[model samples]
Target: MKEFDLIKQYFAQRGHVRKDVILGIGDDCAITKVPDNQHLAVTTDTLISGVHFLADAPARSVAYKAVAVNLSDLAACGAEPAWISLSLSLPSYDEAWIDEFVNGLYELTEYYSVQLIGGDTVTGPLALTITAQGFVPPDTELRRSNAKPGDWIYVTGNLGDAGAGLDILKGNIEASAEHRDYLINRHYYPTPRVLAGTSLRRTANTGIDVSDGLVADLSHILRASGCGATVHVDRLPVSSALFDTVGAQQAYRYALSAGDDYELVFTVNEEQRGNLETSLANANVKATCIGQVNGYTGQLDLRLYDAKYELDKDAGYEHQF
Candidate 1:
């Protein structure tokens, strides 16, 4: 199929329809309205085959992950997702693959009530880029620079499961069938904490989504806020599947350094601690208090029951470029 034909058949007029989108697909530029008194939050992410996902991974999963990761960025800013534009590059046209990919993309956009705006399709290496836009109330957006000393650090949902799942897919680890399926699904379908992030706008002093490992993402908050943190290593949340398959030491290492979990890591000061619990409860999201911010700027201290704990290697994912 030709480029425009492919877009019309699989992408245009598909997915959730948002009223805020004045002009979506088939337009020179997407025209969207920002609600009065709200600010626009925009994020873009690119996923390349073999680099971001396994080259042989399902097209559906690749599409879903592309949308999820960008939405996770908006969630960290406490924005309500409203629209997305996709730029897809494929080595060649594959009808069945495109069908499944559109299904996956629409599945997530529908769940989040996001509309597809506009974008381009090009012939190139397999890669997908999504630019997601959302709305956030002015002065209420969560930011990494807002954290303060004495604030308690909290993370929503378990960590390390996705990393473990990647290892299993790579044949670097083994697990029982049931556990294997669970871990693999965790890797493919990471839940972006949209509801939890919105709830945190009023209570959280600062916030970030755990795209990188917990330690790596938290370091961003520390640096941005000009503060440090003391994380209780034992308090890091690990899924039963990961713990069972990888033992305590390996599980802890994954929790500390592995990426792609997409959970939210936020901070709440003592004054807002009670309200934090209530806010999260209202959203029906569970969060664990894993550490506290400190005065030492840009420092991350990992402690296991009051004893210093150290990782054997560098923590978190980093691109060589």
Candidate 2:
């Protein structure tokens, strides 16, 4: 099938309709209207086969991740996702694969009440790019640079599951079928913390989505905020599946260094922490306080009882262009 035909058949108008969309697919550009007194938050992510996922990864998973990761970015900024534009490149026109991909992609966008705008499809190495747009109230959006010293650090959900999932897929680890499936599913279908992020705007001083390793992504916050932090090794929320499958030491490493878990890492000062916790609790999110911001500049210390260790800067997967 031709590229345009493939896109029209599988993707056109699949995203849920919203009043703000002036024009969606089959146009030179998708036009949208931003509500009054609100700011638009936009983010884009590119996923490549063999790099982002296994070459044989399910098309549904690939499509889902493409959307989830970008939505996670919107969540970090305390925005509600409203629109997405997908640019997909496929090596060949496989009907079943295309159907599955659209099903997964549209399922997520529809769930979030986001509309599909416009994009292009082409023949090439398997890759997908999504540009997501969200909205936040004017003059108050969470940012990585807004964290302050003495603010407590918190993360939603357990960490390292996705990294462990990848390890399982790569044949680098062993586990029973049930445990393996759990880990693999976590890696493939991550929940973006949109509601939690929105709640954070009222309490969190700064935040980021855990796309890279916890330490690496936290470093971005530290650098931007011109501060350091003290993370407790014992406080890392290792999932039971990961802990049982790989034990404490390996689980700790994965939680600290593994990526692809789309949880939120945020900061709240002592004064606002109560409200923050209450808000997240109301939203039914599981969160834990891991540590606090420190005065040191651009350094992160992981504390385990009486001992402290500097995280290896290169520990996580660094996407090299």
Candidate 3:
């Protein structure tokens, strides 16, 4: 099939979309209107075969992840996701593959009420690029530069499941049937903390998504805020399945360095603790206080049972150029 045919066959539907999207798919460029008094938030992410996911993995999952990771960034910025554009590159077209891939993409967009606006298709070693845009109230968007030294640090959802999931997929280790499926699903279908991020926007001092593990992502905030942190390893939230399957130490390693979890790590002031709790409650999400912001510069101090813990500074995934 030709490129335009592929797009029309699988992705041309746009009957229902947010009022902001004036023009979507099939146009030379999509048009959107930002709400008055709100700031436009945009984020983009690219997923490459092998590096980001297993080459033989399900196409639907890849599409879902491509949209999800970009939306995750919008969520981190405390924006309400509204639209997405996709650029998919493949070696060749397969009707069945395209169908499944589009289905996965629609599933997430439908859930979030996000519209697919415009994109391109090309022949290449498989890759998927997504650009998502949203709106956040002016002066209230979460950022990496606002954390204060006395603020309490918190993280939404458990950490390291996706990291463990990836290792299992790569066959480096074995897992029980139930645990394997759970972890694998966690890796493939990550839940972006959109609601939680929105809820925390007015209260959070600073925030970021855990795309590259806790330490690395949090470091972005620390560096931007010009502050340091003390993250308690003991406070790291790991699923019971992870503890039972991989034991504590390995779980700790993955929680600290394994990337792709997409959870939100944020800080709240001591006085705003009540407000933070109330916001998470309204969002029906759970968050754990993992540590505190400190005075040290660009430092990440890991604590284990009250003592300073150490790990590879190279922890977490950094795309090697």
Candidate 4:
């Protein structure tokens, strides 16, 4: 089928449209008017077949994940997703596959109240790129460089679920049916902590999403803020599903080094911790204080009982290309 035919038959007008969007798909450009009091925040991500995802992955999951991950970037910066543009490069257009994909994409965009905007679809090796735009109040956006010494480092939700989930997919371990389903879902669908990030905007000294492993992604905030951290390995939260599927050691490794959690890792001051918790609680977000920022001149430490260690290396997924 032709490209426009494919969109009309399956992909066009598939999601909710927010009021602020002046134009959506079928336009040369999607026009939007940002509220005068708000700042626009935008982020983009691309997923390629056989690289970011398996070749035969579900069409729905692929579509959902493409927008979801980009929204996670928005969440890290405490932005409210308002619109998104999709660009798909494919060998050929297939209406059935496109329908399922658009359905999945619509599900997430609608749930988040984000509108579908403009993008270009081309013929090529399979690649899906999405650019999501969001809004945050002026001067209230969270930044990786804002953390300071003595700030309490925190993370929303449990870590290592996606990492452990990937291992199960590779057949690295045998698991029960329930365990397999749980882990697999963890890999396919990661929840972006939008509410938590929005709430932390006024309180968090710095913030980042745990797209890479916890240790690795948190280091971004540390490096940007010109500081170090001391995380308690024992305090790292591992989900019950993870512990039940894989033992503690494997789960811990996933928590420390496995990627794709899409959770928020942030820093707040000691004195404001109670108020921070209250804010998160109001947003129905759970967060844990895993560490504290140390002085800029000293090395970061992860205190394990009486011992400490340094996490100063490329500790995340290595992508080639």
Candidate 5:
């Protein structure tokens, strides 16, 4: 199939259709409308075969993850997702693979009411890049630079499951049948906390989605906010699947440094603590207080029930180049 034919057959008219998209697909450019009094939030992510996922991973999973990671970035900014443009590079035109991938991509876009406006397709190494755009009310967007000293640090949902799941896929760890499926599913489908993030805009001083592990991502907040934090290692949330499969010590390590859990980590001050709880409860999202921001600028202190804890390896994933 020709590139334009492939786009028309699989993508041009697929997924949720948003009214704000004035012109989508078949055009040189997509024109979208931003609602008055709101700001647009944009994020782009690229996933390469063998680097982001196993080359033989399911096409559905690859497509789902590609969209989810970008949505997670918008969620961190407390934006409501509205549109996406997908650029897909494939080694060959495998119609069956494209079908599965489009199904997975539309599943998420439909759920979030995101429109696939336009993009490009080409023959090359397997890779996918998605540029996702969303909206947030002016002055209400969540940011890493807004955290203040004495604010309580909190994270939505459990951590470390995705990291452990990757290990299982790479044959570096073993789990029982039940635990294995659960962990692998977590790795394949990460939930971006859209509602929770929007709710936090009214309460959280700052926030970030946990993509590159808790320690690494939180350090971004510290550096941006010019504040230090004291995180209680015992407070880091670990799922039953991760803890049961890897034991306490290894689970804690994964929670701290293994990365790829797309849950939100946010900070809320004492004055808004009550409101934070109420807001998240209303959003039907679970969150835990892991620590507090401190006066020491650009420092992160990890404590295990009052004793100092240190990471024995690199904090999180970083591109070598």
Candidate 6:
């Protein structure tokens, strides 16, 4: 099938879209109208074939993650899904691969109420890129720079499952069937906490998604907010399944430094603690108070059960060599 033909067959179907879209695929460009008094937030992410995933990885999962990662960025800023454009770099045309990939992307766009707009495709080494645009109320968008020294730090959901899952996939460890399933799911289908982020926009003083390790990602928030933190290791959330399978200490390590957990890490002023807790409960999300923001400059200190550890100032995942 021709490239445009494939796109029309797989993505141009009306059933695959939700509202707020003025135009979809098949156009030279997607025309959109942002609602009144709303600010648009845009983010783009690229997943290279071998660098981001194995070439043999399922095509559908690759597409889903390609969009999901970009959407995760929009959610961190409390933006509502609006539109997406895709760029594809392929080694060859494989109808089966395209079908599965479009199916997964369509499913997510439908769920998030986003529209598939316009994009570009070219022949090259296998790679995928997604640029997603969302809308948020003016000045109500959450940011990483608003946290104050007296604020409390909190994170949504457990962390490190994805990293553990990757370890298992790479044959570095053996896990039970249940543990394996849990880890694999974590790796494949990470929830981006979109609803939680939106709800907390007005309340959270600082916001970030855990794409990098928690300690590292949270440090971005700290740097932007110009405040330091003391994260209580005991307060970091970890799944019971993790402890049963990976052991407590290992689980703690994973929860702290393992990346790809897409949960939200945020801060709220001490005076708003009660309101923040109530808001999170109403949203049906778990929000754990992990620590407190301090006036210390440029440092992250984590206090475990007995010992304290300070993270290397420059530790984080970087794709470039």
Candidate 3's residue-wise lDDT over 1-321, tens digit each? Answer: 589988877788642488888887897999988989989999989999888888888988998888889889998989999999899998988888888898889989999999999899998889989999999999989999999998999998889999888889889778999999999989999988999889988899988999988888999999999999999999999998788779998899889888889999999999999999998998899999999999898988899998989887676686421
Best by lDDT: 5
**What are the per-residue Cα lDDT tens digits for candidate 4 across 1-321?**
477766555556567867788877776777789998999999999999878876777888888888888999999998988889888888887868877888888889889998878777789988899999999998989999988899998999999988777777777776788878888788788887878878988888888888778877888888888898888877888888888878776776788888888889999998888889999998889898888998763356777664775443565675422
Clashing pairs in 5: none
Error of 3 at 314 (Å): 4.1
Clash-forming residue pairs, model 2: none
RMSD of each: 1.4, 1.5, 1.5, 1.9, 1.4, 2.0
Candidate 3 global lDDT: 0.89
C-alpha RMSD of candidate 5:
1.4
Candidate 5 regions with alpha-carbon error over 4 angstroms:
318-321
- Report model 5's TM-score to 2 decimal places: 0.97
Question: Which candidate model has the greater TM-score, 1 or 2?
Answer: 1
**Would you estimate the TM-scores of all the predictions?**
0.98, 0.97, 0.97, 0.95, 0.97, 0.94
**Candidate 1 lDDT, tens digit per residue, 1-321?**
488988887777567777888888986898889999999999999998888888888888988899999999999999988889999999999999999898888889999998989899999999989999998998989999999999999999999998989889989999999999999998888887889878998888898998889988999999999999999989999999999999988998999888999999999999999999998998899899999999999989999889999986675675311
Model 1 residue 42 CA deviation in Å: 0.5
Off by over 4 Å in 2: 310-314
Superposition TM-score, candidate 2 onto the true structure:
0.97
**In candidate 3, which residue pairs get closer than 3 Å at backbone N, Cα or C atoms, i.e. clash?**
none
Q: Which ten residues in a row have the lowest lDDT in candidate 2?
A: 312-321
Q: What is the C-alpha lDDT of each candidate?
A: 0.90, 0.89, 0.89, 0.83, 0.91, 0.82
Off by over 4 Å in 3: 14-16, 318-321
Worst window of 10 by summed lDDT in candidate 4? 312-321
- lDDT of model number 4: 0.83
